[model samples]
Target: MRADAQKNRDHLLAVAGTAIAEQGVEVSLRDIARRADVGLATLLRHFPTREALLDALLRTSFDELTARAGELETSSAPDEALVSWLRDCVVWTTEYRGVTVLMAAAIEDPDSALHASCVTLRSAGARLLARAQAAGTARGDIDGSDVFALVAMLAWLGDQPSLAPRAERLFGVVASALLTSAGGS
Candidate 1:
């Protein structure tokens, strides 16, 4: 790809980042084009459809998340690291409600970013869970999917800032329960 094409793609992603996060995959391409200060033709030249743009954004965000999870896994105590990651996950999900909604849709599509994202996040979850369980600090029965579910709920709650304090309390309870050693063994 030439430098100009790359530059256009990058610019599109930047504009799409916020738009997609706010409006979701169903957001108008024309709106995105306008926001980027580019024409609809140029926008389509880079991303053919809303789905493609969404897939790219989801791919970019989740990939970064799992990568960060990897770093957290080896950097500290298992329970502490998992808690830290959960906090980070809440923040990320809350940032873009559109992306959050798109992720739900993508997971249903066969060739969506959700499939790859699941694998990535799951691997990170496994590593983190393993360490926590090994140290008797986390429940072994906690599945990777559970963490995703909690994250999704938190993301949805982000829209209602009024409920933040309540959500935080709920999150603390659930996280503590998940991280505590099961059966007191």
Candidate 2:
């Protein structure tokens, strides 16, 4: 890409990130172009599709989240690290109003542009869950899929207008239930 073209793409990505963060993923591409002071054709040339744009916009954050999980695995206790990362995942997935739904769908669809990032995100949490289970802090029977489902469920709950306020507390309860000690004899 030429210097001007690269500048336009960078500006578009930054503007789109702010717009989507403020207005949700449903914000119009035309509006993004307008906000970035770029023509619609320029935006299209940079990102051929909405998913492509989204994939570009979210890829960095997803990578950061995955990296954070690895850092937490080394820096925190197994269960604490898992729970902390899970909480962070909830926040990441629900940052934009409609993003949780997008992530949930993308995680299951290999054809989606966001699929690889979503898989990486899930794998990060799975690694933490595996560590916790191995340490006997989390339930032995629960696997990475279970942890992924819990994160997805929490993200879904957060997307609900009525349930959004209760999401954190609900997450706490669910996280507690996933602990080995929570299942008292």
Candidate 3:
């Protein structure tokens, strides 16, 4: 990509991220282009589709989450690290309205542009989960996919206006249930 094209793409991604964060994922792409002072054609040229644009916008957040998981793996106890990273995953997935639903679908769609990133995000959680299981802090039966599903469910709850208030408490309950030590053993 040329310098100017790369600059345009970066600016569009920034504007789109803010727009989606503030207005939900349904924000108009044309409006985003206008806000970025770029033509709709140019935006399409860069992103190709709404999912592509979203994939680009969210890729950085996923990468950061993965990196944070790596950091927590060393800095915290296995259980604490898994819990902390799962909490962060919820926050990341729920950053934009409706994003949780998009992610739920994207993670299952091998052709989605966001699939690889989502997989990486889940793998990060999986690493922590494996460590916790090894330490006997978490349930031995649960795997990374289960952890990912739980995070996605929490995020879905976060996206619901009526359920938002209880999401944190629910997360705590679910987290406790998944922890082996919480069984009073």
Candidate 4:
């Protein structure tokens, strides 16, 4: 990409990120372009699709979360690592309103632009869950998919205006339920 094009793309992504954070993943492409001081055609030229723009914006965060899971696995206790990573994932998901829905769909759709990043993130969570289970800290019945689902559920709570206040308490409840002992807090 040329310097000017790359600059435009970066500016568009920055505008899109703010828009999504304020509105949601479903925020209008035209609004994003307007916010970026560009024409709709320019935004479309850079992103091609909403999913593509989201992939570009969110892929870095996804990679960081996956890497965080690995770091937690080695540096923290099994139960602590699992709960900490779970909290981080849920918080990140909540940053972009309605992103949990996209992540859930992306995880199941191989052709989705976000699929690979979602898979890697889910796998990282699964590894932490497995590690905790092996250490007899987390429940053995739940697998990585269950952990992923829990993240979506938690993020959904944060999305709801009525339920937003209860999200933190619910997160603690869910974490407690997942852990065999009282260590999830």
Candidate 5:
């Protein structure tokens, strides 16, 4: 693509990501094109289909989350790193319910790029889980997939404002349940 075309495509992806996260993965291509101040043809040129656009959006999110997780690895405290990951997960779930759901769904589809992204995240999450488990700050039996499932449920719960307190407590509860210690947990 040309420079301007690439710029427009980038803008469309940004708008589409925000739209999908806020509205749904089911959002129309025209809707994203309109939001991006681009024509439908341009949107189509960038993302040939809903599935393709979704794959791109999920990949972008995975990039961000993975980068965040990578940064956490530099932290000296494994427990703190786990907590940070949990917090990041909660934020993603709460703010982007549709995208979060999309992410979960993507993991189920073998051919999806989103599935590839999930694999990367799952691997990183497993490493973090191992660190915490080794430190006795979390359960040794916990699998990364379980963490994924819990976060998916939390994301679904994120839309309920009345459940704000419970929403906030969800991560802590899960963390406590995973911990080997009694008092601190």
Candidate 6:
């Protein structure tokens, strides 16, 4: 891509990110174009679709979270790593309102633009969960898919106005329940 095109793309992504964070993943594409001071045709030429735009915006963060899970696997205790990754995912999901729904759907639909990133992210969390389970630190009954579902649930809780205040406390409770040691040996 030319320097100017890249610059325009970056600006669009930045504007889209802010719009999604403020309004949600479903925020108007026309609004994003207006915010970026670009024509709607320009935005569409760059992104093509809402999913494409979201994938472009979120892919970097997803990659980082996946890499972070890998680092935590080697650097932290199994249970600690799992809980930390879980917390990070929930926090990230909450930042983009209504993203959990998309993530959940994307995970189930291989054809979705977000599918690959969501799968990789979920797999990263699963590895941490598996490591904890192997060390007898986490419950063995739940698998990676369950962990993914829990992340969606936790993020959803964070999105709820009535439950937002209790999200941190509830996260602690959920994290504890995931770890066997938290319940006393």
TM-scores, one per candidate: 0.86, 0.90, 0.92, 0.97, 0.87, 0.97
TM-score of 3: 0.92
Give the Å error, residue 126, model 3. Answer: 1.0
lDDT of the candidates, in the order given:
0.75, 0.88, 0.89, 0.94, 0.75, 0.93
Alpha-carbon shift of residue 33 in model 3 (angstroms): 1.5
Candidate RMSDs in Å, in order, are: 2.9, 2.5, 2.1, 1.0, 2.1, 1.5
Runs of candidate 4 exceeding 4 Å displacement? none
- The whole-model C-alpha lDDT of candidate 5 against the native structure comes to 0.75
- Worst lDDT 10-window in candidate 2: 176-185
Most lDDT-accurate candidate: 4
Rank the models by TM-score, top first: 6, 4, 3, 2, 5, 1
lDDT (Cα, tens digit) per residue for candidate 2, span 63-174: 9999999999999988898988888888887776678778888999999999999899889988988888888888888877778788778988988889989998999898
Q: lDDT tens string, model 4, 4-123? A: 889888888889999999999999999999999989999998889999999999999999999999999999999999999999999999999999999999999999999999999999
Q: What does candidate 4 score on TM? A: 0.97
lDDT of 3 by residue, 84-159 (tens): 8989989877888778777778899999999999899889999998998888889998899899899889998998
Clashing pairs in 6: none
The CA lDDT at 172 in model 6 is 91
What digit string (tens of lDDT, one per residue) describes model 1 on residues 111-134?
864677756765676677777888
Over the stretch 1-118, how does candidate 6's per-residue lDDT look in tens digits?
9999999999999999999999999999999999999999999999999999999999999999999999999999899899999999999999999999999999999999999999
Off by over 4 Å in 1: 21-25, 181-185
Off by over 4 Å in 3: 182-185
Per-residue CA lDDT of model 5 for 88-138, tens digit only, reads 876876765466666677788888767888878777777777877777777
Against the true structure, candidate 6 has what lDDT? Answer: 0.93
What is the Cα-based lDDT of residue 44 in candidate 2? 96
Candidate 3's displacement at residue 173, Å, is 1.1
Residue 180 lDDT, candidate 3, scale 0-100: 90
Error of 6 at 24 (Å): 0.4
Report the lDDT of model 3 for residue 173. 90
